[model samples]
Target: MEITGNKFALIGLGDFGAHLAMVLSEKGAEVLAIDQNMDNLEEVKDSVAHTVCLDATEEKALMSQGIDEYDAVIVCIGDEFEETLLVVTVLQSLGVKRIIARATTPRHAQILRHLQIKEVILPAVDAADRLANKLLFQSKLSSLELSSDYEIIEVDAPDKFVGKNLRELELRVHYDVSLITIKRIELKPRLLGGTREVEHIIGIPSPDTVIERGDVLMLFGKKESVQRMMAD
Candidate 1:
């Protein structure tokens, strides 16, 4: 869960493994990247704490490198079932504490699950879900995922909400959303009498603050409620 120690071994330095290694390292984790391919190892050598050209399926070789002592081991040789299975089997035999694996197909996921691998990632499916969410909330200025069920989105106030105030909407009571902030643009007369649009930020608006048209709201709530509010 925490990726900041020198306690992770990332095997099969493919795209996923390499990127993960770099990210963990960037977050202050000392990552050891292993790959049978010299080119793969070379590409990520300088980025990680260590890079090993290793045939990880060999139990003796894997253990010799002390990979079993790591807090977690990640297997990314998913396309090569035999190699991946052997690597995981060796990790188990060595009593590695935690294992994360990538699943190339449904069958691969099932097989890994049968091995009692607790965390399995299906990259394509994960990517597709992310793309779908991007499309679903594309109209929003931005969307931040706080958890699987909660999100914060900055969206244009719904048309029906124009001229309505926070108390009148009863957002929390009705929609389970909190109007955190409102960015308002209004025309104000200058000292010379000519009016110019001045920007005003309403921070944590009171119950009676009216929601004028052209207001951008930062709303926080459950994903379902936010989605429903945006749609309705």
Candidate 2:
């Protein structure tokens, strides 16, 4: 995760931006933090490589600080759309390699897209989607989208499939699906400087491993085939 020798600038020093700066710093990036508010700048002083209390829209001042040297710039001014747009345009004009922006609304996102901003983040919307999924699909077990028409899902092993090896199960012949992995809970000792044990299943499980109750069997197939397998 080291970002050594890579320069990154972040505009806005609010909660979202501050958190991102801390993470990037921890990952070994040379982070330059910017905010108009002195208090916000002070808050992240210890986490970043440098902090500047200046408006990002000041193109000359920003350039003086060598904004062009940065590998990427993240515009995180969530409240002021105009300021965000200004900063984005300035960054683009300065030839920054990549620009990522945060938008608070769909209309703002549309505006950024029209301006040719390559990346836009709607944190609130993404958080809502994750929360809703957790609530409604508490028993989802595991799910992954392979393509528009295909998916892979792992669910708690049903009673009928207990003690059956994957070969005996004949998943492809009978259900037109493939067993991709077997997930089971096992306690492992905590690592050095770690406080808790980890529970994870090994991947690419052996063929003779028998399915058991509470075991999560990951399977892959076309959407229709997966749906039929789960229905049984």
Candidate 3:
């Protein structure tokens, strides 16, 4: 759980926000906890790097803290939908590098999607562990837990594994893991004079398919075995 040297800003220090901030800090991330309520700030002041009591909806207040420079900003307001939307809008206007907002309802989530917010989360489903994993596991884009011990995760190709093929890697025999598939990036030319990179999964990869630099490897295995493979 220890992820080193990542910095994050957590807005709205409610129960969910407070727990997430503490978990991130415990996992070696520098967290700035922000909220309008002084009590919320006081609760996590000792746990995080810095705590600020300010109205997140105010663009000036958000700018004053230089949240744009953080690795990511998480808006964790759950009760007031308007306030959450306003805060998210202000954050968007301010051009914060990355924003992850909490959606209380399906409608709220849909609205966030309309805003083109890539990461909209529900506090009820996305608890501390998931959020922590999202923020900490930069290489691990997503994961699905099948049981207490087994899971599937999509991870970026490791540096050491940039050029090798599956047969050479011997993933199953050596690491006790299975390569589900590979998500490779290819440029799709647009109608106008532009080409944008798109990710598509190379279904059921053969042993000869070589791993590339930007390839996302879908791996399935026991939790401990997966961790061991990544560490190795």
Candidate 4:
């Protein structure tokens, strides 16, 4: 996976933080890895564009690094709930455009959401591939709304999802969702640039249709249930 040019600042160089930094860097985004501990910074230094050891709780120190200039900042402060909240609040005050934080518990996730951080993640549960896939297929709104209670969004097949046939996944039986369509995308080489080519497999999919990792699923379900499925 490669993004031509994007920049990210990842705070807290713990296991998940380190992995996230490495993946984003490999995907061609410039990553700035930060942590108070020099050891953590050193561990990921080779994988990222820059690594800094500084106390994120100190607004002056963090601001000195020009953190707000990054495209997005990720708060990966694990275990220190209050400390995480403090850092997040300071970032919010700085008016960061996007803050993706890791919440250790559901309550923490709720608080992050309350702070208007749309991308609060569960720590320890997210793998590098899963996170990357989420970033890849997380949908942007189209000029459409299906209904008040249901809608359609394109999502990547979950990383752990084996190429399961539609019947085996039991999306409808268990989640009360409908598979609307499947879209396959490829890049078409052009003289000056790359053009996206989309091929659609729309309809009541045959039971034999199996889900693949990069395949995009167009699904319709109750809003809450669809969100749960997507979050999973």
Worst 10 residues of 4 by lDDT: 189-198
- The CA lDDT at 26 in model 3 is 91
Q: What is the lDDT of candidate 4?
A: 0.76
lDDT of 3: 0.81
Using TM-score as the measure, name the better of candidate 1 and candidate 2: 1
Each prediction's TM-score against the native?
0.61, 0.59, 0.60, 0.56
What is the descending TM-score order?
1, 3, 2, 4
**CA lDDT, every prediction?**
0.79, 0.78, 0.81, 0.76
Query: Candidate 1: RMSD over Cα atoms?
Result: 17.8
Query: For candidate 1, lDDT tens digit of each residue in 101-203?
Result: 8878767877777898867767776566447644654644344447676667677888899988888899898889888888776655433222334445677
Error of 1 at 32 (Å): 0.4
Candidate 1's TM-score reads: 0.61
Clashes of 3: 0
Worst 10 residues of 3 by lDDT: 189-198
Q: Positional deviation of 102 in candidate 1, in angstroms?
A: 0.8
Candidate 4, clashing residue pairs? none
Best by TM-score: 1
Candidate 1 total steric clashes: 0
